[model samples]
Target: MIATVVGVGLIGGSLAISLKEKGVANWIIGVDHSQENLAKAQELKIIDEGSTLEDALQRSQLIILAIPVDAMLKALPSILDKIQPHHVIMDVGSTKEKLLQLVAGHPKRGRFVAAHPMAGTEYSGPEAAVRNLFVQKTMVLCDVKNSDEDALELIESMVDKLNMRLVYMNAEEHDLHTAYVSHISHITSFALALTVLEKEKEQGRIFELASGGFESTVRLAKSSPDMWVPIFKHNRSNVLDVLDEHIHQLQQMRELLAQEDYDTFYKLIQKSNKIRKILK
Candidate 1:
Protein backbone atom coordinates (compact mmCIF):
# COMPACT_ATOMS: atom_id res chain seq x y z
CA MET A 1 0.00 0.00 0.00
CA ILE A 2 1.06 3.57 -0.68
CA ALA A 3 0.61 6.05 2.20
CA THR A 4 0.69 9.84 2.01
CA VAL A 5 1.90 11.95 4.94
CA VAL A 6 0.66 15.54 4.68
CA GLY A 7 2.99 17.35 7.08
CA VAL A 8 6.39 15.67 6.76
CA GLY A 9 7.32 17.08 10.14
CA LEU A 10 8.28 15.18 13.29
CA ILE A 11 5.09 13.15 13.73
CA GLY A 12 4.52 12.64 10.02
CA GLY A 13 8.11 11.73 9.23
CA SER A 14 8.30 9.35 12.19
CA LEU A 15 5.03 7.69 11.16
CA ALA A 16 6.27 7.35 7.59
CA ILE A 17 9.36 5.54 8.85
CA SER A 18 7.32 3.22 11.09
CA LEU A 19 4.81 2.36 8.37
CA LYS A 20 7.53 1.13 6.06
CA GLU A 21 9.35 -0.72 8.87
CA LYS A 22 6.18 -2.52 9.88
CA GLY A 23 5.20 -3.33 6.29
CA VAL A 24 1.99 -1.31 6.56
CA ALA A 25 2.92 0.71 3.51
CA ASN A 26 5.32 -0.34 0.79
CA TRP A 27 5.74 3.22 -0.48
CA ILE A 28 5.28 6.51 1.36
CA ILE A 29 4.57 9.82 -0.36
CA GLY A 30 4.88 13.10 1.50
CA VAL A 31 2.91 16.33 0.99
CA ASP A 32 3.72 19.52 2.83
CA HIS A 33 3.33 23.29 2.41
CA SER A 34 7.13 23.60 2.63
CA GLN A 35 9.04 22.23 -0.30
CA GLU A 36 12.12 22.41 1.91
CA ASN A 37 10.51 20.05 4.41
CA LEU A 38 9.52 17.68 1.64
CA ALA A 39 13.01 17.79 0.25
CA LYS A 40 14.48 17.26 3.69
CA ALA A 41 12.21 14.29 4.31
CA GLN A 42 13.24 12.75 0.98
CA GLU A 43 16.93 13.40 1.67
CA LEU A 44 16.56 11.74 5.07
CA LYS A 45 14.83 8.79 3.40
CA ILE A 46 11.81 9.45 5.60
CA ILE A 47 9.66 9.54 2.47
CA ASP A 48 9.97 7.64 -0.79
CA GLU A 49 8.96 10.84 -2.60
CA GLY A 50 7.14 14.13 -2.10
CA SER A 51 4.06 15.10 -4.13
CA THR A 52 1.30 17.65 -4.03
CA LEU A 53 -1.77 16.77 -1.96
CA GLU A 54 -3.85 16.27 -5.09
CA ASP A 55 -1.33 13.94 -6.69
CA ALA A 56 -0.59 12.10 -3.44
CA LEU A 57 -4.30 11.58 -2.79
CA GLN A 58 -4.74 10.14 -6.25
CA ARG A 59 -1.96 7.58 -5.81
CA SER A 60 -2.11 6.67 -2.15
CA GLN A 61 -4.46 4.28 -0.36
CA LEU A 62 -3.97 5.78 3.11
CA ILE A 63 -3.56 9.46 3.99
CA ILE A 64 -2.07 10.53 7.32
CA LEU A 65 -2.69 14.12 8.32
CA ALA A 66 0.04 14.97 10.86
CA ILE A 67 -0.25 18.75 10.66
CA PRO A 68 -1.43 21.13 13.40
CA VAL A 69 -5.09 21.02 14.48
CA ASP A 70 -5.88 24.34 12.81
CA ALA A 71 -4.38 23.21 9.49
CA MET A 72 -6.18 19.90 9.84
CA LEU A 73 -9.50 21.70 10.22
CA LYS A 74 -8.96 23.64 7.00
CA ALA A 75 -7.49 20.76 4.97
CA LEU A 76 -9.65 17.84 6.17
CA PRO A 77 -12.91 18.79 4.46
CA SER A 78 -11.17 19.23 1.13
CA ILE A 79 -9.31 15.96 1.54
CA LEU A 80 -12.56 14.23 2.37
CA ASP A 81 -14.07 15.86 -0.66
CA LYS A 82 -11.57 13.99 -2.83
CA ILE A 83 -11.28 10.63 -1.06
CA GLN A 84 -12.26 7.53 -3.00
CA PRO A 85 -14.01 4.57 -1.39
CA HIS A 86 -10.67 2.83 -1.02
CA HIS A 87 -9.00 5.74 0.70
CA VAL A 88 -8.88 6.15 4.50
CA ILE A 89 -7.68 9.39 6.11
CA MET A 90 -6.50 9.66 9.71
CA ASP A 91 -5.30 12.67 11.69
CA VAL A 92 -2.75 12.72 14.53
CA GLY A 93 -3.65 16.11 15.89
CA SER A 94 -3.40 16.81 19.63
CA THR A 95 -6.83 18.37 20.23
CA LYS A 96 -9.93 16.74 18.73
CA GLU A 97 -13.12 18.57 19.75
CA LYS A 98 -13.04 21.35 17.14
CA LEU A 99 -11.87 19.19 14.26
CA LEU A 100 -14.43 16.49 14.95
CA GLN A 101 -17.19 19.07 15.19
CA LEU A 102 -16.13 20.65 11.92
CA VAL A 103 -16.62 17.43 9.96
CA ALA A 104 -19.37 15.91 12.08
CA GLY A 105 -22.06 15.61 9.45
CA HIS A 106 -20.15 15.80 6.22
CA PRO A 107 -21.26 13.36 3.48
CA LYS A 108 -17.84 11.70 3.32
CA ARG A 109 -17.19 11.78 7.05
CA GLY A 110 -17.16 8.01 7.18
CA ARG A 111 -14.03 7.95 5.06
CA PHE A 112 -12.08 9.95 7.64
CA VAL A 113 -11.01 8.74 11.09
CA ALA A 114 -10.17 11.01 14.02
CA ALA A 115 -7.06 9.88 15.90
CA HIS A 116 -4.57 11.42 18.32
CA PRO A 117 -1.36 9.48 18.78
CA MET A 118 -0.28 10.16 22.37
CA ALA A 119 3.39 10.27 21.42
CA GLY A 120 6.02 12.86 20.42
CA THR A 121 9.09 14.73 21.60
CA GLU A 122 10.05 18.35 22.25
CA TYR A 123 11.08 18.65 18.64
CA SER A 124 9.81 19.15 15.09
CA GLY A 125 10.72 18.84 11.40
CA PRO A 126 12.02 15.92 9.32
CA GLU A 127 15.42 15.83 11.04
CA ALA A 128 13.79 15.17 14.41
CA ALA A 129 11.98 12.12 13.07
CA VAL A 130 13.01 8.93 14.81
CA ARG A 131 12.24 5.26 14.25
CA ASN A 132 9.80 3.40 16.55
CA LEU A 133 8.49 6.65 18.01
CA PHE A 134 4.99 5.17 18.37
CA VAL A 135 6.01 1.80 19.78
CA GLN A 136 3.99 1.00 22.90
CA LYS A 137 2.48 4.49 22.85
CA THR A 138 -1.26 5.09 23.12
CA MET A 139 -3.28 5.98 20.02
CA VAL A 140 -6.64 7.50 20.91
CA LEU A 141 -9.41 7.14 18.35
CA CYS A 142 -12.24 9.61 18.85
CA ASP A 143 -15.79 9.32 17.55
CA VAL A 144 -15.08 6.02 15.87
CA LYS A 145 -18.79 5.26 15.57
CA ASN A 146 -19.03 8.00 12.99
CA SER A 147 -16.42 6.27 10.83
CA ASP A 148 -17.07 3.39 8.49
CA GLU A 149 -16.22 -0.04 9.84
CA ASP A 150 -13.62 -0.62 7.14
CA ALA A 151 -11.97 2.71 7.82
CA LEU A 152 -11.85 2.09 11.57
CA GLU A 153 -10.62 -1.46 11.09
CA LEU A 154 -7.85 -0.37 8.77
CA ILE A 155 -6.57 2.17 11.28
CA GLU A 156 -6.84 -0.34 14.12
CA SER A 157 -4.81 -2.81 12.10
CA MET A 158 -2.22 -0.18 11.34
CA VAL A 159 -2.02 0.80 15.00
CA ASP A 160 -1.57 -2.83 15.96
CA LYS A 161 1.14 -3.30 13.39
CA LEU A 162 2.83 -0.20 14.71
CA ASN A 163 2.79 -1.87 18.17
CA MET A 164 0.76 0.92 19.76
CA ARG A 165 -1.98 0.68 22.37
CA LEU A 166 -5.47 1.57 21.11
CA VAL A 167 -7.88 3.67 23.14
CA TYR A 168 -11.44 4.74 22.30
CA MET A 169 -13.13 7.91 23.45
CA ASN A 170 -15.54 10.61 22.39
CA ALA A 171 -14.24 13.97 21.22
CA GLU A 172 -15.18 15.81 24.42
CA GLU A 173 -13.53 13.26 26.71
CA HIS A 174 -10.40 13.11 24.58
CA ASP A 175 -9.87 16.86 24.68
CA LEU A 176 -10.57 17.20 28.42
CA HIS A 177 -8.31 14.34 29.52
CA THR A 178 -5.48 15.43 27.23
CA ALA A 179 -5.71 18.93 28.73
CA TYR A 180 -5.02 17.44 32.15
CA VAL A 181 -2.29 15.02 31.06
CA SER A 182 -0.70 16.46 27.92
CA HIS A 183 -1.60 20.11 27.30
CA ILE A 184 -1.00 21.21 30.89
CA SER A 185 2.51 19.74 30.87
CA HIS A 186 3.53 21.81 27.87
CA ILE A 187 2.01 25.00 29.25
CA THR A 188 3.67 24.50 32.63
CA SER A 189 6.99 23.79 30.96
CA PHE A 190 6.73 26.91 28.85
CA ALA A 191 5.85 28.99 31.92
CA LEU A 192 8.65 27.50 33.98
CA ALA A 193 11.14 28.22 31.22
CA LEU A 194 9.97 31.81 31.03
CA THR A 195 10.14 32.17 34.79
CA VAL A 196 13.71 30.96 34.87
CA LEU A 197 14.75 33.14 31.96
CA GLU A 198 13.22 36.18 33.64
CA LYS A 199 14.50 35.58 37.16
CA GLU A 200 18.02 34.47 36.27
CA LYS A 201 19.32 37.53 34.46
CA GLU A 202 22.78 35.95 34.24
CA GLN A 203 22.09 33.73 31.22
CA GLY A 204 25.24 31.64 31.52
CA ARG A 205 24.42 30.86 35.17
CA ILE A 206 21.34 28.93 34.02
CA PHE A 207 23.39 26.56 31.91
CA GLU A 208 25.93 26.16 34.73
CA LEU A 209 23.40 25.53 37.52
CA ALA A 210 20.57 23.70 35.72
CA SER A 211 19.98 20.22 37.14
CA GLY A 212 18.36 17.11 35.63
CA GLY A 213 15.04 17.83 37.29
CA PHE A 214 15.01 21.43 36.06
CA GLU A 215 15.98 20.38 32.55
CA SER A 216 13.24 17.75 32.38
CA THR A 217 10.64 20.13 33.79
CA VAL A 218 11.42 22.81 31.21
CA ARG A 219 12.11 20.54 28.22
CA LEU A 220 8.69 21.01 26.63
CA ALA A 221 9.44 24.73 26.44
CA LYS A 222 11.56 23.82 23.46
CA SER A 223 8.48 22.58 21.63
CA SER A 224 7.34 24.56 18.63
CA PRO A 225 4.75 27.24 19.39
CA ASP A 226 3.26 26.60 15.96
CA MET A 227 2.20 23.17 17.16
CA TRP A 228 1.19 23.99 20.76
CA VAL A 229 -0.65 27.29 20.17
CA PRO A 230 -3.27 25.58 18.01
CA ILE A 231 -3.74 22.85 20.61
CA PHE A 232 -4.30 25.45 23.34
CA LYS A 233 -6.69 27.42 21.13
CA HIS A 234 -8.80 24.41 20.20
CA ASN A 235 -8.89 23.05 23.75
CA ARG A 236 -9.22 26.48 25.33
CA SER A 237 -11.95 25.65 27.86
CA ASN A 238 -10.32 22.48 29.13
CA VAL A 239 -6.85 24.06 29.29
CA LEU A 240 -8.22 27.07 31.17
CA ASP A 241 -9.89 24.77 33.67
CA VAL A 242 -6.65 22.86 34.28
CA LEU A 243 -4.64 26.10 34.44
CA ASP A 244 -7.02 27.47 37.07
CA GLU A 245 -6.42 24.45 39.27
CA HIS A 246 -2.68 24.62 38.65
CA ILE A 247 -2.58 28.27 39.65
CA HIS A 248 -4.61 27.52 42.78
CA GLN A 249 -2.13 24.83 43.79
CA LEU A 250 0.79 27.17 43.17
CA GLN A 251 -0.88 29.86 45.29
CA GLN A 252 -1.31 27.43 48.16
CA MET A 253 2.37 26.54 48.02
CA ARG A 254 3.39 30.19 47.84
CA GLU A 255 1.19 31.06 50.82
CA LEU A 256 2.60 28.21 52.85
CA LEU A 257 6.18 29.25 52.04
CA ALA A 258 5.49 32.91 52.77
CA GLN A 259 3.87 32.07 56.10
CA GLU A 260 6.87 29.83 56.98
CA ASP A 261 4.57 26.87 57.59
CA TYR A 262 7.18 24.20 56.96
CA ASP A 263 4.99 21.39 58.31
CA THR A 264 2.14 22.14 55.93
CA PHE A 265 4.49 22.66 52.99
CA TYR A 266 6.11 19.30 53.68
CA LYS A 267 2.70 17.67 53.87
CA LEU A 268 1.70 19.21 50.55
CA ILE A 269 4.77 17.74 48.89
CA GLN A 270 4.11 14.36 50.53
CA LYS A 271 0.58 14.40 49.20
CA SER A 272 1.88 15.12 45.70
CA ASN A 273 4.13 12.08 45.94
CA LYS A 274 1.05 9.92 45.42
CA ILE A 275 1.74 10.35 41.72
CA ARG A 276 4.82 8.13 42.10
CA LYS A 277 2.74 4.92 42.26
CA ILE A 278 0.62 5.93 39.25
CA LEU A 279 3.63 6.89 37.13
CA LYS A 280 5.99 4.13 38.12
Candidate 2:
Protein backbone atom coordinates (compact mmCIF):
# COMPACT_ATOMS: atom_id res chain seq x y z
CA MET A 1 0.00 0.00 0.00
CA ILE A 2 1.09 3.55 -0.64
CA ALA A 3 0.42 5.73 2.39
CA THR A 4 0.48 9.48 2.66
CA VAL A 5 0.94 10.91 6.14
CA VAL A 6 -0.33 14.49 6.51
CA GLY A 7 1.52 15.76 9.60
CA VAL A 8 4.96 14.11 9.63
CA GLY A 9 5.14 14.83 13.36
CA LEU A 10 5.40 12.30 16.18
CA ILE A 11 2.25 10.27 15.40
CA GLY A 12 2.56 10.51 11.62
CA GLY A 13 6.28 9.80 11.60
CA SER A 14 5.90 6.87 13.95
CA LEU A 15 3.03 5.48 11.89
CA ALA A 16 5.09 5.83 8.72
CA ILE A 17 7.97 3.94 10.33
CA SER A 18 5.77 1.12 11.61
CA LEU A 19 3.88 0.70 8.32
CA LYS A 20 7.13 0.42 6.36
CA GLU A 21 8.80 -1.84 8.91
CA LYS A 22 5.79 -4.17 9.06
CA GLY A 23 5.45 -4.26 5.26
CA VAL A 24 2.02 -2.66 5.38
CA ALA A 25 2.95 0.41 3.33
CA ASN A 26 5.36 -0.14 0.47
CA TRP A 27 6.07 3.60 0.26
CA ILE A 28 5.21 6.63 2.38
CA ILE A 29 4.72 10.14 0.99
CA GLY A 30 4.58 12.88 3.60
CA VAL A 31 2.56 16.12 3.56
CA ASP A 32 3.25 18.83 6.11
CA HIS A 33 3.07 22.62 6.25
CA SER A 34 6.44 22.66 7.95
CA GLN A 35 9.20 22.21 5.42
CA GLU A 36 11.71 21.48 8.16
CA ASN A 37 9.55 18.66 9.54
CA LEU A 38 9.16 17.20 6.07
CA ALA A 39 12.93 17.36 5.53
CA LYS A 40 13.59 15.82 8.93
CA ALA A 41 11.13 13.00 8.28
CA GLN A 42 12.87 12.25 4.99
CA GLU A 43 16.33 12.43 6.61
CA LEU A 44 15.16 10.07 9.35
CA LYS A 45 13.83 7.70 6.66
CA ILE A 46 10.34 8.04 8.12
CA ILE A 47 8.99 8.88 4.65
CA ASP A 48 10.20 8.01 1.20
CA GLU A 49 9.19 11.42 -0.20
CA GLY A 50 7.40 14.61 0.75
CA SER A 51 4.72 16.33 -1.36
CA THR A 52 1.71 18.63 -1.17
CA LEU A 53 -1.53 17.14 0.14
CA GLU A 54 -3.09 17.27 -3.31
CA ASP A 55 -0.16 15.48 -4.93
CA ALA A 56 0.08 12.89 -2.16
CA LEU A 57 -3.66 12.25 -2.33
CA GLN A 58 -3.43 11.53 -6.00
CA ARG A 59 -0.61 9.03 -5.52
CA SER A 60 -1.42 7.18 -2.31
CA GLN A 61 -4.10 4.59 -1.63
CA LEU A 62 -4.27 5.40 2.08
CA ILE A 63 -4.10 8.88 3.61
CA ILE A 64 -3.33 9.22 7.29
CA LEU A 65 -4.22 12.51 8.96
CA ALA A 66 -2.05 12.81 12.05
CA ILE A 67 -2.28 16.57 12.37
CA PRO A 68 -3.67 18.51 15.35
CA VAL A 69 -7.41 18.55 16.03
CA ASP A 70 -7.88 22.13 14.80
CA ALA A 71 -6.03 21.45 11.59
CA MET A 72 -7.93 18.25 11.09
CA LEU A 73 -11.26 20.09 11.41
CA LYS A 74 -10.23 22.55 8.74
CA ALA A 75 -8.51 20.07 6.44
CA LEU A 76 -10.86 17.11 6.66
CA PRO A 77 -13.71 18.46 4.53
CA SER A 78 -11.39 19.54 1.73
CA ILE A 79 -9.54 16.28 1.84
CA LEU A 80 -12.80 14.40 1.77
CA ASP A 81 -13.81 16.54 -1.17
CA LYS A 82 -10.86 15.19 -3.10
CA ILE A 83 -10.84 11.50 -2.18
CA GLN A 84 -11.72 8.82 -4.75
CA PRO A 85 -13.62 5.65 -3.88
CA HIS A 86 -10.37 3.70 -3.85
CA HIS A 87 -8.67 6.02 -1.37
CA VAL A 88 -9.02 5.49 2.38
CA ILE A 89 -8.59 8.39 4.81
CA MET A 90 -7.98 7.97 8.53
CA ASP A 91 -7.34 10.40 11.35
CA VAL A 92 -5.46 9.92 14.64
CA GLY A 93 -6.77 12.96 16.45
CA SER A 94 -7.09 12.80 20.26
CA THR A 95 -10.67 14.05 20.22
CA LYS A 96 -13.31 12.84 17.74
CA GLU A 97 -16.84 14.21 18.24
CA LYS A 98 -16.40 17.57 16.56
CA LEU A 99 -14.34 16.11 13.73
CA LEU A 100 -16.82 13.37 12.97
CA GLN A 101 -19.62 15.94 13.02
CA LEU A 102 -17.83 18.23 10.59
CA VAL A 103 -17.49 15.54 7.96
CA ALA A 104 -20.76 13.78 8.70
CA GLY A 105 -22.67 14.90 5.61
CA HIS A 106 -19.79 14.96 3.18
CA PRO A 107 -20.34 12.94 0.02
CA LYS A 108 -17.08 11.12 0.54
CA ARG A 109 -17.62 10.44 4.24
CA GLY A 110 -17.71 6.73 3.50
CA ARG A 111 -14.11 6.88 2.37
CA PHE A 112 -12.98 8.22 5.75
CA VAL A 113 -12.33 6.28 8.94
CA ALA A 114 -12.05 7.80 12.39
CA ALA A 115 -9.29 6.08 14.39
CA HIS A 116 -7.34 7.01 17.49
CA PRO A 117 -4.27 4.98 18.35
CA MET A 118 -4.17 5.23 22.13
CA ALA A 119 -0.38 5.42 22.33
CA GLY A 120 2.11 8.26 22.41
CA THR A 121 4.93 9.77 24.42
CA GLU A 122 5.27 13.32 25.80
CA TYR A 123 7.08 14.29 22.66
CA SER A 124 6.56 15.70 19.13
CA GLY A 125 8.29 16.16 15.76
CA PRO A 126 9.86 13.75 13.29
CA GLU A 127 12.84 13.02 15.54
CA ALA A 128 10.47 11.91 18.29
CA ALA A 129 8.98 9.21 16.06
CA VAL A 130 9.66 5.65 17.21
CA ARG A 131 9.07 2.30 15.57
CA ASN A 132 6.42 -0.06 17.02
CA LEU A 133 4.86 2.76 19.02
CA PHE A 134 1.38 1.33 18.36
CA VAL A 135 2.24 -2.30 19.01
CA GLN A 136 -0.18 -3.80 21.53
CA LYS A 137 -1.89 -0.44 21.97
CA THR A 138 -5.62 0.08 21.61
CA MET A 139 -6.86 1.66 18.37
CA VAL A 140 -10.31 3.09 18.87
CA LEU A 141 -12.57 3.28 15.80
CA CYS A 142 -15.30 5.82 16.32
CA ASP A 143 -18.68 5.56 14.52
CA VAL A 144 -17.70 2.68 12.30
CA LYS A 145 -21.34 2.33 11.25
CA ASN A 146 -20.98 5.61 9.38
CA SER A 147 -18.02 4.36 7.40
CA ASP A 148 -17.99 2.12 4.34
CA GLU A 149 -17.25 -1.48 5.21
CA ASP A 150 -14.31 -1.59 2.83
CA ALA A 151 -12.77 1.58 4.29
CA LEU A 152 -13.29 0.28 7.80
CA GLU A 153 -11.77 -3.08 6.92
CA LEU A 154 -8.72 -1.46 5.35
CA ILE A 155 -8.02 0.42 8.60
CA GLU A 156 -8.76 -2.69 10.68
CA SER A 157 -6.26 -4.59 8.56
CA MET A 158 -3.73 -1.80 9.05
CA VAL A 159 -4.33 -1.97 12.80
CA ASP A 160 -3.75 -5.73 12.66
CA LYS A 161 -0.53 -5.23 10.74
CA LEU A 162 0.62 -2.80 13.43
CA ASN A 163 -0.20 -5.42 16.11
CA MET A 164 -2.76 -3.21 17.84
CA ARG A 165 -6.00 -4.07 19.58
CA LEU A 166 -9.25 -2.81 18.00
CA VAL A 167 -12.00 -1.04 19.90
CA TYR A 168 -15.28 0.33 18.56
CA MET A 169 -17.24 3.29 19.91
CA ASN A 170 -19.49 6.08 18.72
CA ALA A 171 -17.90 9.52 18.40
CA GLU A 172 -19.74 10.90 21.43
CA GLU A 173 -18.83 7.99 23.68
CA HIS A 174 -15.24 8.05 22.51
CA ASP A 175 -14.90 11.77 23.32
CA LEU A 176 -16.46 11.40 26.76
CA HIS A 177 -14.29 8.42 27.74
CA THR A 178 -11.09 9.99 26.44
CA ALA A 179 -11.81 13.09 28.53
CA TYR A 180 -11.87 10.89 31.62
CA VAL A 181 -8.91 8.65 30.79
CA SER A 182 -6.48 10.63 28.63
CA HIS A 183 -7.35 14.33 28.62
CA ILE A 184 -7.70 14.60 32.39
CA SER A 185 -4.33 12.95 32.91
CA HIS A 186 -2.52 15.45 30.72
CA ILE A 187 -4.27 18.37 32.40
CA THR A 188 -3.39 16.96 35.82
CA SER A 189 0.23 16.49 34.83
CA PHE A 190 0.43 20.03 33.47
CA ALA A 191 -1.14 21.43 36.63
CA LEU A 192 1.13 19.38 38.88
CA ALA A 193 4.19 20.54 36.98
CA LEU A 194 3.04 24.13 37.34
CA THR A 195 2.48 23.71 41.08
CA VAL A 196 5.97 22.33 41.62
CA LEU A 197 7.53 24.98 39.43
CA GLU A 198 5.72 27.70 41.33
CA LYS A 199 6.77 26.38 44.73
CA GLU A 200 10.35 25.47 43.84
CA LYS A 201 12.17 28.75 43.21
CA GLU A 202 15.33 27.01 42.18
CA GLN A 203 15.20 24.70 39.10
CA GLY A 204 18.40 22.98 40.26
CA ARG A 205 16.70 21.99 43.51
CA ILE A 206 13.82 20.39 41.61
CA PHE A 207 16.26 18.37 39.50
CA GLU A 208 18.15 17.29 42.64
CA LEU A 209 15.02 16.24 44.55
CA ALA A 210 12.99 14.74 41.70
CA SER A 211 12.25 11.01 41.86
CA GLY A 212 10.89 8.55 39.30
CA GLY A 213 7.27 9.19 40.27
CA PHE A 214 7.69 12.95 40.08
CA GLU A 215 9.37 12.65 36.69
CA SER A 216 6.63 10.45 35.28
CA THR A 217 3.83 12.63 36.63
CA VAL A 218 5.32 15.78 35.10
CA ARG A 219 6.31 14.21 31.77
CA LEU A 220 3.05 15.02 29.99
CA ALA A 221 3.56 18.69 30.85
CA LYS A 222 6.36 18.55 28.33
CA SER A 223 3.92 17.75 25.52
CA SER A 224 3.52 20.33 22.79
CA PRO A 225 0.85 22.99 23.31
CA ASP A 226 0.26 23.11 19.57
CA MET A 227 -1.29 19.68 19.76
CA TRP A 228 -3.08 19.87 23.13
CA VAL A 229 -4.66 23.33 22.98
CA PRO A 230 -6.85 22.43 20.02
CA ILE A 231 -7.88 19.24 21.79
CA PHE A 232 -8.96 21.22 24.85
CA LYS A 233 -10.69 23.71 22.59
CA HIS A 234 -12.62 21.08 20.65
CA ASN A 235 -13.54 19.03 23.74
CA ARG A 236 -14.08 21.98 26.06
CA SER A 237 -17.21 20.83 27.84
CA ASN A 238 -15.98 17.29 28.52
CA VAL A 239 -12.57 18.45 29.72
CA LEU A 240 -14.11 21.09 31.96
CA ASP A 241 -16.42 18.49 33.44
CA VAL A 242 -13.52 16.21 34.29
CA LEU A 243 -11.42 19.10 35.59
CA ASP A 244 -14.21 20.21 37.93
CA GLU A 245 -14.44 16.74 39.41
CA HIS A 246 -10.68 16.57 39.77
CA ILE A 247 -10.60 19.89 41.60
CA HIS A 248 -13.36 18.73 43.90
CA GLN A 249 -11.40 15.60 44.76
CA LEU A 250 -8.33 17.67 45.51
CA GLN A 251 -10.34 19.95 47.74
CA GLN A 252 -11.72 16.98 49.61
CA MET A 253 -8.22 15.70 50.26
CA ARG A 254 -7.05 19.16 51.34
CA GLU A 255 -9.90 19.49 53.81
CA LEU A 256 -9.20 16.07 55.22
CA LEU A 257 -5.53 16.92 55.68
CA ALA A 258 -6.41 20.27 57.27
CA GLN A 259 -8.67 18.55 59.79
CA GLU A 260 -5.89 16.07 60.61
CA ASP A 261 -8.20 13.23 59.65
CA TYR A 262 -5.54 10.64 59.03
CA ASP A 263 -7.98 7.75 58.93
CA THR A 264 -10.15 9.34 56.23
CA PHE A 265 -7.10 10.45 54.25
CA TYR A 266 -5.72 6.92 54.34
CA LYS A 267 -9.07 5.56 53.22
CA LEU A 268 -9.18 7.99 50.33
CA ILE A 269 -5.79 6.83 49.11
CA GLN A 270 -6.85 3.22 49.50
CA LYS A 271 -9.90 3.93 47.43
CA SER A 272 -7.71 5.54 44.78
CA ASN A 273 -5.52 2.45 44.65
CA LYS A 274 -8.55 0.57 43.29
CA ILE A 275 -7.37 1.90 39.93
CA ARG A 276 -4.79 -0.89 40.05
CA LYS A 277 -7.55 -3.40 39.27
CA ILE A 278 -8.51 -1.57 36.10
CA LEU A 279 -4.99 -0.69 34.95
CA LYS A 280 -3.28 -3.95 35.77
Best candidate according to lDDT: 1
Please write out the lDDT profile of model 1 over residues 121-223, one tens digit for every residue.
Answer: 9999999999999999999999999999999999999999999999999999999999999999999999999998899899898899888999899999999
Q: What 10-residue stretch in candidate 2 is worst by lDDT?
A: 52-61
For candidate 2, the per-residue lDDT at 253 reads 99
**Model 2 TM-score, 2 decimals:** 0.99
Model 2 alpha-carbon drift over 4 Å, by segment: none
Clashes of each: 0, 0
For each candidate, what TM-score against the reference?
0.99, 0.99
Model 1 accuracy (lDDT, Cα): 0.95
